[model samples]
Target chain A: MLKYNFSAGPCVLPQEVFKKAADAVLDFNDLSILEISHRSKDFVQVMEQAQSLAFEHLGLQDKGYKALFLGGGASMQFLMCAYNLLENKAAYLNTGTWSAKAIKEAKMFGEVIEVASSKDSNYNHIPKSYSVPSDVDYFHFQTNNTIFGTQLQETPSVEVPIVCDMSSDIFSRQRDFDKYDLIYAGAQKNMGPAGATLVVVKEEILGKVSRSIPSMLDYKVHISKDSMFNTPPVFPIYVSMLTMQWLKDNGGISWIEELNNKKAGLIYNEIDRNPLFEGFVTDKADRSKMNATFVLKDEAHKDAFDQLWKDAGINGLNGHRSVGGYRASMYNALSVEAVETLVSVMQELERKG
Target chain B: MLKYNFSAGPCVLPQEVFKKAADAVLDFNDLSILEISHRSKDFVQVMEQAQSLAFEHLGLQDKGYKALFLGGGASMQFLMCAYNLLENKAAYLNTGTWSAKAIKEAKMFGEVIEVASSKDSNYNHIPKSYSVPSDVDYFHFQTNNTIFGTQLQETPSVEVPIVCDMSSDIFSRQRDFDKYDLIYAGAQKNMGPAGATLVVVKEEILGKVSRSIPSMLDYKVHISKDSMFNTPPVFPIYVSMLTMQWLKDNGGISWIEELNNKKAGLIYNEIDRNPLFEGFVTDKADRSKMNATFVLKDEAHKDAFDQLWKDAGINGLNGHRSVGGYRASMYNALSVEAVETLVSVMQELERKG
Candidate 1:
C-alpha cells in the first residue's frame, strides 16, 4: 500500500514533517498535543511560531500584514472575505468553482461584477484579460482551480485592492508578496492539514466595510487577537508549523517552485508527446503547475490507463468528479522521482496503445 | 515534565487514546493520517464511525437525528443554531458568559426573550425557576458553564423545541436525549481537541428559518452531505472517535458520571472541610461536576496553594483570568487519583494554615 498520494487537498506533506507530527501527537514537549491548553505558554509559543512562519514563508513580515491561523477551512473564507471587505461593491473573475462560490458569497454583501470568465470552455484556461472597475471595493479571484487544472499565471494588477484564494497553489510559487491586499488559503493543499486556514491581510483594509461582522468572521478581530479569538485547531496548526519550517529549510518558495515546475513540466511534456493522451487544458500557459489534468485520446483506453496506474502503485490519479479525467496533483511533497514513475507509466500506455 | 493536566480544554484525554492517535498519525493502516484523502475509503469509514459513535453515545440512534462533525468550534454554532432555528422569536436562559454570547448571536436572527438569567449574581448558580413561553420558536440553553462552574441539572421542558450547547459537559453524563431538537458541542472539553464541532440535529427542524444561511453554516447542508460539506478537521475528529470509543469500553456515560461525581465530591468535600478553601457556586446542586471552581479562604494563601499544586505536578488548575481563583476540571478522562492528589494538597494547605 505504499503509493504516491495524488490527492488535490489534504495531500501529502514532507515525510519528516509527518514524523515530527506523530511525535508531537504522542507528547508535545512532554504534554500530549491532544491535551495542551490553548492558553498554556507552550501552546501559545506554538501558535506564535506558526503565524510567524507562515508570514515568513509568504514574505509578508514588517509590511503591516498580519498572518492568522484560524479554525475553519477556505470554504468559510468565501463568506468571510465578503463580510470583511465587500463594502458597496466588488469585482470577481470567474475562473472556476471556487471563484464562482466566492462571487455567490460576495453577492450577499454587495454588488459584484464578474470582469471576465472562461466557463464557456469548461474552464480549460484562465482568462487572459479582465477589466476591473475602480468603483468596486476589491477584485477577487482564485489562484488555482483544483477541478479544472487551470491557474492564474499573472497577478492581476488593478487600481483597487486584490483578494486571492491561494488554497490550491500557495507555497508552490513565489509571487510579489506585497501585491495583494488580502490572501487566504486552506492549509490542506500545500501547507498541512484540513483544519486550519491561513489568512494574511493588510491591517489598513479592514473596518472599511459598512457592515457589522461576527467576531470570528471579521479579519480585524483575528488580526487584533493574533488568531486566538477562540480555541483554534491546535494539531493542524502544529503540523503546519512543521511543514512551513520544512519549506524554510528546503530553500523556501522559489526552490519549491522550481522543483514543482520540473515535475509538472515532465508530466505535461508526456501528455503532449504521447499519442494516446492529451492535456485537458486548452491554453498551455494557463495550465496549473500543481494539478495537471489530462484525458486519454480515446475512450477505449480508459480501463487500461486505470489498471495501469493502479498496478503502478499510484493513488488519487482519478480526476475530480465534476470534470472526469486524470488529475495528478504535484504539491511540494510529491517527489520528482514519483513524477518520473508517472512519466514511465505514460510511456507504457503509449506503447500499449 | 510528567504532570496531571487540569486545563479545562483542550484538556486531557485517555492515555490509551493518546497512544492510539500517535500511532495513527505515524501510519494509519500504512497511510499517514495526514496524507489520507477525505474521500478515501478508509477515511470515509473513519468519518462514518465517528458520527455513529457520537449519536450512539447520545442515545439518539434512529431517532431522526443526524450527527455532524464540522470544522468550526462551538462559537460558530452559536450563530448557526440561531441562523437555522430562529424564526419569529426564541427564548434564552442566560446562565453565564456562553449563554449570554448565544443570546447575542440569536438576537441577530429574531426576537430573543431572556426567560431567566443568573448573571445578576455573577452566574454563581443556574436559575432554578423560569417559565419558557410556548409561543417562541425554540429555546436555547447551555448545559454547563466552564468559567462559572454552573450546570443545568434538569432539562428544560419546553413546548416548542429545545437547543443546547453541550461544549463543556458533553459525554460527562447522560440525560434524556430525546427531549432536545438540537445539541452541539465543541470537541475539546469532555470530547477531544479544539477543531471539530459535534452537532446532532433533528432532521425535521431545519429549513424553517426564513433567511439564507451560508452553506458552511447551514446544518441541513452539512447533514445532507454527512458533514463532508467541506474538508473536515480530520485529526481532531479521529482523536474524538478514539476517546468516545474509550468511553464506551469504560462503561459509557453512566460509569464516567459516577467517576466524575466521585472526583467532584472529593474536591467539594475538601473545600467544605478545609478552612483554607471555599466553593464558588452558591447552589451545591447547580455546581458543575466537570469544572470544579473554588478559591482559597484568604488571598494571603495564594503563593502557598499555587506552590502546593505545582509541587504536586498539576497543570491548568488556575481558574480563568475573568474569575480569579482555581478550577479543577474533572472531565471524563481525569482520574479519581488525580483528584485525590488535589484533595491531599488542599488538606496539606489546611494543616499549614
Candidate 2:
C-alpha cells in the first residue's frame, strides 16, 4: 500500500529532499555528510546556503535579520527568547500548550503580562482583540496551536517588537515577514527533521537584557559567530537547505499556500458535509491549515472508522492525547491526493455506519 | 583513494553504520526516519535501546545513572550542569580550551575555583598534584582535550560529586564508570554525528540547587520525560545507537581500548622516531589516546609534509590554530589500519626531506 505521512512533525518532508539527504549520507563531496567537519568549506557552504535560503523564503533578505539554524528545538527558544529580551516585562498571547510553556519560561526572566488566552475552552479557538501593554519589553504569541488545531490567520498589529513562534505553520502562507522582530520554528514541520531549529531575529532587539546569558542560549553570541558558535546540527541543516531549495524551486511560500489551502479544503469540507464526523475547533475561521482535528459523532462507529483510515495507508493520523481524536496534518509536503484518500476513508466509514 | 577522516568531529563513524543510516533515511519501518514521530513505538524503542546500550557500555547498569540523549551539544550542558549542581561553588580543572569554557559557564551560577591549570604552558600537559577542594559543590574536569591532545588518565579521588565532559573520548576506553555523578559527551566523536549529546547523570545529586532551572536545561526533567520532553535529534541518536551496537559487537570498551592504544602508539612512535617531527605534549604520560598532537621539527618542511599526507588521502590532519601543527584523532570507529596509513605518510615526508 502507498503511504501518506500526516505526522504533526518530525513530519513529512518532500520525497526529493529525502532522496538527496540519503545520497549525502553516502557521498557528499566524497565525504559522508555525517563525518565532515562543520567548518570545512563544503559544510560551511551548506550552512551559508541554508541561512540565505531562509532569508530568501521569508522575504527578509538584507533586512537586518540574521538566520540561524541552532539545535535544542523550539523549546529552547522559549527560554532563550525570554533570557535575551525579557528585561522588566513582556506581553504574551497564550493560545495553547506551547504558548503556556513559553510563558512559563519567560516568567523566570521577568514579569509576564498575558494579553489574552484561549485555554478556558481547551484552546478550541484563537483569542482575538487582545491588547498589548505599550510599556512591555516585547510581545510574543504562537502563530498556530498544533494541539488545539487553531491558527491566528493575521499578525497582531502590536506596537512593541513582536516575537513569534511559528513552529507549526511557518512559511506555509503569505505574511509580512518583517513585522516580527524574532521568528523561530523547529525544522521538523515543513523544513527538515527534528534536530535543528530555525531562528530569524532582528539584530536591534537583542542585547537589551541586563542579565548575562549563557553562550549557547544567547542569540547575539550565535549571530556573531554566524551560527557556528558551536558545532551545528549539520545533517539536519543540510536536509533543511534541500527542503528550502525545494520550496523555492517549486515557487516559494506563495505557491505552497495555494496547494495547502486546497488540501485543507478537501478534508475540512468533507467533515462539514458528512454527518458522522464533527470538527473539534469551535470556530471554522480559526482551523489550522496545517493540522485538522476532528472526531466521529457516534462512538459506536469508532473502531470501523479507525480501520478505514488505517487500511487506506495513512500514518500519524492519531490526535494528541490532550485532544483525544484524529488529527490529519496537512503540511507543505502533503499532497492533495493524500487528503482525498483520507476523505474517501471518512466517506467509506459513513457508508458502513 | 581511501580517505581517512581525522576531523575533531562531526567526525568519522563506521562505514556500516553510515550504510544503515542512509538506508533508514530512505525507509525506516515504511517511513523516512526524518518523517516518523519521535513518540512512535519504533523510535521509542530506539531511544530505550540507546539508553540501555549506554548504560551497558559504561558498566553502570543497575546503578543510579540515567542515560539521556539530548540536543544543543555539550555546550548546553556547561550551563545546565552549573544551574542544577552549583549552589555556592564548584572546582574545575582547567586542562585546555574546553575546560576553560566549562569553567566560564560555571562562574555564572556561583563561585568557580580553578583547582589547577596548565594554561601557562599552553595546555601542553594535564596538571598534576592538584587537590580538588572538598568544600566545593562538585569537582569538574574534561577527560580528553582534543585541541591540545592531553587527557586525564584516572578519575580523581575527590570526595565531592564529580562532573565530567568526555566529548572526544567517551567509550573509547575502559574506566570506573560509577566514580562520577555526571558525564556528558558530544555525539560527533566516537558515537555518531554532531547534533546530539549523550548525558549520563546520577539521580541523587540533583534537586540540591536553589535556582529555578529552565525545563530544557534540567536533566531531571529530561530524565522524567525519558529524554522525550520535546522532539529530539532523531537521526543523530539513531546513528549513535548503531555505532554503540557496532562497538558492542566488536567486544565493547576493553576491546576498543586495546585498538585505540595501538593506534596511538603507532603514530606517537613515528612522531618521536622521525627527525622531522616532534610530539606537542610536555608529559608523555599525559598524552591522549584519542588525539595525538605533533608538529614538524622545521617549518621549511611544512609544505612537503602537507602534500605527502594529502597525497595519501588523509583528511583533517591539520592541527588547530591555537596549537599549530597536526592532530590525528583516533576515535572508536577509526581503524588501526587508518593510523598505519597516517604513520606511513609521516615516514614518506621524512624520506622526502
Candidate 3:
C-alpha cells in the first residue's frame, strides 16, 4: 500500500534520496558510508558538496553566508545562537512552541524582550504589529510554526541582524535568503531527515560577543573548520546533500514553492468547503502551507473519517495531543497526489454523513 | 580482496549491522527508518532496546543507570557535563587531545583542576601517578586515548563522582560500570557510526548544579523525556541499536574483549619482533588495546611499509599529525584475521628490509 506520511518531524523524505542513501550505507567507493572517516577525502567531498548545494538552493552561494549541517537539532541552536550572538539583549516574536523554547534558552545568555506573542490564542496567528528594538543584539522569530499550523510568509524588516528558525518550511518556499543574517532548519521536515540541522549564518556577525563560547556551540569554531571541528553525523549530512541535489535537480525553491502551494490549496480548500470540518487556525492569512490543521465540525463523523483516511493508505495524520484535531503536514517531498487523496477521504466522510 | 579498516572512528562496523541498517533505511516497519517519527511506538521500542542492550553489555542493567543515545558527539558532552554537574571545581587527568579539550570546556562552567598530565611527554603514555581532589564536583578522565594509543585499565578510585569519556573503547571490554557516575562515547567507534553519542549517567547524581542549564544541555531533561527531547539522530540511533544487538548476540563484551586482546597481541608482538618497526608507547601496561600506535625504526622503510599495508587491503593506517607514524584502531567489529593480515604486512616489510 502507498501510505502518505504526515508526521511532523523525522518525517517524509524523497524516495530517490532514500535509495541512494541506502546504497551508500552498503558501499560507497568500496567502503561503507558508515565506516569512512569524516576527514577522509571521500567524506570531505560529501561535506563540501552538501555545503555548496545548501547555498546554491538558498541562492546565497558566494555570499558571506556559511552553511553547516550540524547535529543536536534546532533545539541546540536555541542556546548556541545566544552563546555566540546574544550580548545584553535580544528581541523575539513568540508565535508557537518552538519560538517560546528558543526564547527560554536565549534568556539564559541575556535579557530577552518579547516583542510580541500569540500565546493567548494558543499561537493560532502570527503577531504582525510589534516593532523590534534596533538597539537589541538581534531579532529572533520562527518562520513556520509546525504544531500550531501558522507561518510568517514575509520576512520582517529589521535594522539589526535577523535570526530565523525555518525548521519546518525551509526550501519549501521562496524567500529573500539574503535578508536574514542567520537562518537554521532541522532536516527532519523539508530537507532530509532528523539528526542534522542546517545552519546558514553570515560569518561577519560572529565573534562579537564577549563570553567565551564552548567549541561545539561556537559557530566561529565550526565555520573556521568548515563544519568538521569534530566528527559530524556522516549519514545525515550525506543524505541531506542527496536531498539538496534532488531539490536542485527538480528546480530549486521556486519549483517546489508552486507545488507546495497546490498541495496546500487542495487540502485547505477541502477543509473550508466540507461542512463537516473546520480549520484550526482562525485567520486564513495565518495558515501554514506546510502543515494543514483541521477538525471535524461534527464529532459523530470521527470514526468514519478515521477509517476513510486509513483505508486510503494515509499515515501520520493524527494531530498532536495539544491540538485535538487532524494535521496534514505536506513537506517538499509530499506530492500533490497525497494531498488529493487526503482531500478525497474528507469528502467521503462528509458524503457518509 | 577483503579490506581491513583501521580508521580511528566513523570506522568499522559489523557487516551484518551495515546490511540491516541499509535495509532499514529503505524500509523499516513499512516506512523508511529515516522517515519514521521518533515518538512512534516502533522507534520507541528501538530506543528502549538500544538503552537496555547498552546497560546489559556494561553490566549496569537495573542498577540506577540511564543510557541516552544523543547527537552532537562526545565533544558536546565536554561542556554538557560541566553544565549539569560542575558547580565548584572538577578534577581532570589531561592525557591527550580529548582530555585537554574536555578540561577546556569544563573551565567555562567552573574551576577545573588538572590532577595530572602526560602532555609534557607529548602524551605517548598515560600518567601513572595522579591524585584526584575529593572536594571537586567530579573526577574526569578519558578511558582510551585514540591519538597516542594509551588506555587506563583500572577505574580511578575516587570518593567524588566519576565522569569518563570512553569514545574510542566502549563495549570492547568489561569493567565495573557502576564505579563511574557518568560515561559518554561517540558512536563512531565501537558502537555504530558517527552522529549519535552514548551517555550513561547515574540517576542520583544529576540536578546538583546551580547554574541555569539549557534544556538541550541538561541530562535530567533528556532523562525525563527518554532521550527524545527533540527529534534524535534517527538513523544513527537505529544503527547503534543494531550494533548493540549484534554485540549481544555474539556474547557481549567478554566475548569481544578476548578477541580484541588476541588482535592487539598479534600486532604488538609483530611490531616488537620486527626490526623495522618500533612501538609508540614504551610502557606496555599503558598501551591501548583499541588503537595501537607505532612507528618505523628507520624512516627509509616508510614507503615500503605503506605500500605493503595497502597491498594487503589495509586502510586508514596513517597516524594523526601529532603522532607521525601509524595507528591501527581495532574496534569490536574488527576480526582477528584482519589483525593477522596487518601483522603479516609488518613481517613482509621486515623480510624485504
Give candidate 2 regions above 4 Å deviation: none
TM-score per prediction, in order, is 0.98, 0.99, 0.99
Consecutive 10-residue window with the lowest summed lDDT within model 2 chain B: B1-10
User: Which prediction has the highest lDDT against the true structure?
Assistant: 2
Ranking by TM-score: 2, 3, 1
Error of 3 at A78 (Å): 0.8
Candidate 1's displacement at residue B132, Å, is 1.4
Model 1, C-alpha of A122: deviation from truth (Å): 1.0
Model 2, B48-124: lDDT tens digits are 99999999999999888899999999999898999999999999999999898899999999999999999999999
Ranking by lDDT: 2, 3, 1
- Which residue pairs clash within candidate 3? none
lDDT of 3 by residue, A41-153 (tens): 99999999999988988899878999998999999999999989999999999999999999999999999999999999988888989999999999999999889899998
State the weakest 10-residue window (summed lDDT) of model 2 chain A. Answer: A1-10
Q: Per-residue CA lDDT of candidate 2, range A1-353, in tens?
A: 24889989889999999899999999998889999999999999999999999998898999999999999999999999999999999999989999999999999999999999988899999988779989999999999888889999988898999999999998799888899999999999988999999999999999988999989999999999999999999999999999999999999999999999999999899999999999999999999999999987888888888788888898899899999888999999998889999999998887878
Superposition error at B316 for model 3 (Å): 0.4
Q: What is the interface RMSD of candidate 1, in Å?
A: 1.2
lDDT of 1 by residue, A234-259 (tens): 99999998998999998999899999
What's the residue-level lDDT of A226 in candidate 1?
77
